[model samples]
Target: MSAGAPPVVTEIARPWWDALARGEVAVQSCSSCAGWVFYPRPFCPSCGGRDLAWRTVDPAATLYTWTVAEAPVSPHFAHLHRPVLAVAELGIGVRVPTTLVHADPDDVRIGMALTPVFDAGTYPGFTLLRYRPA
Candidate 1:
């Protein structure tokens, strides 16, 4: 995401990221199609609706799928303090993704219910959304 000539946000999304400092997570919900959209775009993907708004989610989800990080790409990743889990799935029928934390490899599996967790430690230069086995 850093190969761009410049960052996508300057004045558009600083408020969204800054909201994490106060403890909240949101996704753009299209008032037209009633679909949830991520990456916080200004329009809806399914219906191409211009009427979109930020909606707070329950921070609870499920481990639809995941993988283990056995290889390291950067020092930042090496010292992550523990192995990582990436999960995705049909929440409200929208495929939401977030890192999985606080669960053992054996304890986690696809279809397991998970919940959103704010990992200040996993803050990737900004606050990040993570999940734990719900």
Candidate 2:
């Protein structure tokens, strides 16, 4: 099998992805309710507001949880050696699911400070957002 495929950039998420390409991590914020949103949606989940805007936020986050992948579930992941997958809660209260890189699985702990790692070389035309100890 081939390496993992890149994410498809949709119209709704283009700004967020574009920001990532520029080495800036951004999330959607509701203009009406001032709520933070992830996964890129047309409306705000907090107040069901249609007025939403992309906002740059601090890349710092707290590792909420994580798991280690010892074996490749697919050929795309064969290159990864015991990759650590983590869910981190950003400073803005958004929980982002991302890979934890440049870290030992054994050393990772809950509540550890993490910062964003944008892998622009991994996938052409797209940047893979990972995290590392801060």
Please name the candidate that would achieve the greatest TM-score relative to the true structure.
2
- Name the TM-score of candidate 1: 0.75
The digit string of per-residue lDDT tens for model 2 on 60-115 reads 89999999998986788998889898998998889988999889998999999998
Query: For candidate 1, which ten residues in a row score worst on lDDT?
Result: 1-10
The lDDT of each candidate is 0.66, 0.88
lDDT of 1 by residue, 1-134 (tens): 12112224555466556655456766678899898877677778899998988766666676777877777545556654445567556356556656677878777788888776765554344666677888
**Pairs with steric clashes in candidate 2:** none
- Measured on C-alpha atoms, candidate 1 has an lDDT of 0.66
TM-score of each: 0.75, 0.93
Q: Residue pairs in steric clash, candidate 1?
A: none
